[model samples]
Target: MPGHLIRKPDPCIYSQFLLMQLNQPVTWDNPDVRILSGGVEQYTYDLTADTEYTVEITVHNSSRDKPADGTAVSIRWIEFGAGSQTRHAIADRVANVPIWPGTAIVTVPWRTPATPGHYCIEVELAHPNDGNPTNNLGWNNTQVHAAQSPVDRSIRIFNRYPRDCPPVDEGGGPYLDYRRAIYGWGALGAIGALLYAHVGHEGGMGHSYAVSVLAFYAIAAAAGLVFYRLHNERLRPRAAVARAATGGHADCHRVEVTVDSYEFDDATGKDFHPDTVFAGRTVVWPAHVDPPSFIFQPGEAFRDVTFHTDAPDDPGPPGHFNINVRQGGEPSGGVTLTITRGG
Candidate 1:
């Protein structure tokens, strides 16, 4: 330790890391529910007698299976969404589909009940009664929807504006360098005037002044170019926190906010867009709209997704906090948001 610490561990990261390493219950009762899949591994399932519930089953691209279980099935169930209305709101309305490993399974199209309902959905892995029917051999967890708003993004997506960057005055800035560029060389050409003045015994002094002006004029031109580049290079917004609201309108389904990494759940609480948005990375929702995972375009690089998660992670899986932005209809063309992390 010295008078000043240059690079210290981030309290936020350290705090979260400490949390992950701690042993805690990820499920309601025990370690029954856990996120073993890839991105956005949480969901909510709504059950209505006549309504259709669609559950998109994604496997952990890599093998995280145990031979003892042999095969893992992803079954959908409804419970409460963490602080849900009540435990009995969605009394045991399980779908009639069983998803086997290695395949994308979706529940048949069916309408949900006409009455209002709330249920926490989870994917549990069920295996042979090796004697424990209580053991959900599948991925059992509840996911949230996209309706919820995002939470604070101070240390996550927004960081302080860097110093050493040239001060950018929107309307006005120092222009002394500009005037000098076009005319600084004036002394080079102004020599004639100085020579004429010297013919009268003052030219020597005039010539000296002319050369000095010419030299600085050249220097100013180079300096001006450097300044312009720096200004243009400052594309990212200044370090500051800002928030805007958009919803209760006809076109509220399309919301795209550029963030480092946000949690995004679906509207049903069954499927949050992203159950987990690792700190320091950016995520964009409406993931389907973007297509092909990464949202890179012909000329730019970067993808931005909405953070979707407002569920319960009993053991504190950083459950999820998000900020919501309402994006209108489908984009006419694809878009790429370039987010800068640090200076």
Candidate 2:
């Protein structure tokens, strides 16, 4: 005879079902925010100093069941960088969200800062019963510049950290040591030539052998000097100036600048289906910081860094160039310079 056994319900599963019924489900339906450039749909563009521009902030409600009425939207501008930024309030407004997915655009008149430089835009949305507040903010920190050959641009670097931070100089120290080693080798070659001449005279070596030995030394020194000069030319500093702020001492900081170009092909697909292939990636300038590194005082300090680029003479296929700046291996800022070639 077989005995029938009844299985008991798991207490953990029962408790989980009770908790799910008691707690309200969390939904991500907050307002989506975006900042549009003046008179254009573009979110990022260059702004003129002391000039007035009309910027638009668009807010959208994603939840179909929730209607956000009188949603408070605020817009602010800040200096373009990765670290601390001083925010300047642009404007604040209210918008009404319909029951269905709806959008509201708030226009704001912004006057650029007196000092000319790159800036970033930030937008925030506030609702009383918003489900998710994390996605209530949006930032636009990219800028585009157009220029011809011999493009020159200036950027301001600052040490926004509380303590003294040294700028990373990737090429300076090693390059300096390399030059010293080359010089030492040259000196050794000179001394060896003199010794060789004296030994040849004493050993009754012919002038032909002496000439050959001297030629070998000269050839080695010449090759070393040429290689050294070529390396120096490749790593020469374009232009970089550092000036300490008031009450701050001047310190050198290394600025690493990189220029990259990319072209897209519509016919080719990338990792994802239908995605355009990113082809023809040409590194215009490799990542190298001239002057190696710069120093910063104990407090906040500013430096003026400039870099240059030369456009191709042929104006080949249309592509865009990205100039990125990094400090301490962190992305400080960058700009996308677009180039369009006509058929």
Candidate 3:
């Protein structure tokens, strides 16, 4: 009998099979990107025009077996405004992501534009074999400002869409129509006049009654026209209806406002009190206890919100704070105000 033929599995085929079993899908969603003004602890601070800052992009790998050896990150900045923004490239960086819970933070130096105004930051990641590419892009559009004590800053909340926004419904319907009610009142005035005319009268009483009736109808007509004009104004495009339900027919959309204070160390670029870094800061306007919410009309797309902070006569150490506004739990806009204590 011929010797049994001995065959061995091909090394290349075996390696390919092992790779297929061990490799898993990679996603770019695990990374966290931020724009740091000073150090890492400073979180997100305001950026000054014509100044250099650092952009930190932390790339994380969720796969335990596979590691993302080399990942590309791109940073860009855009002019501060609503609607379509023009993006300008800042810089590109490469980060090495380790396996499992390990993360690689890629920091890039950025020089802000000379034009003095607020700006928006954007960061993007690219990988050769990325499984999911949807979450690779991130945006930092929060505005930052620096002011001295007695801080009086006006924050503009812009509604990009050209349409009216009604107040969020809470049980009962929040919308109202004054046009119909005014019309009803006018009709009633007419009926009252006709009834007086049917009951014929003579001399002074008749003249006086006729005059009163004419006066009443005249006032009603004038009031109707006034209400009509006001109604048309509220219905204009991009206006925000923010009237209280009990006050008027037009109810504006409401937004939540939040303020946070932090004691920052200019030397180290870190917060002095890390434990209470995000504590609420006291403000003169928008009472800390009963902070009033803001409303947007239908046609008014851009609205300015002014906030005041009465810093102590001897305002402790130099610090900074941030004002954030949200609509329906979504961030509409915000500003980081750095306190500049005057000597």
Measured by TM-score, the strongest candidate is: 3
Error of 1 at 308 (Å): 15
The C-alpha lDDT values of all candidates are 0.30, 0.51, 0.51
lDDT per residue, candidate 2, 1-343, as tens digits?
3312322111000011121123311111111223345555543445678877777666666566656677887888877643325778999888776643356667887888889977767677787666545546555545444445555555455565536555434345555645654566555665666777676553434456556456546666667666666665555442122333323442323345555554322231234332234233565533222333455445555565554555454645534555444555444444445543333
Candidate 1: list runs displaced more than 4 Å.
1-49, 61-76, 83-111, 128-261, 264-277, 280-343
Candidate 3: tens digits of C-alpha lDDT, residues 8-78: 11100001112112321111111245666667533342556787778777666645655666677778876
Per-model TM-score, in order, reads: 0.24, 0.44, 0.45
What are the runs in model 2 whose C-alpha is more than 4 Å off? 1-46, 80-84, 98-101, 114-117, 142-144, 150-152, 157-160, 164-297, 302-310, 316-335, 339-343
User: Model 2 lDDT vs. the true structure?
Assistant: 0.51
Clash total of candidate 2: 6
**Which residue segments of model 3 deviate by more than 4 Å?**
1-54, 61-74, 79-94, 107-111, 124-148, 164-253, 262-292
TM accuracy, model 1:
0.24
In model 2, the worst 10-residue window by lDDT is 8-17
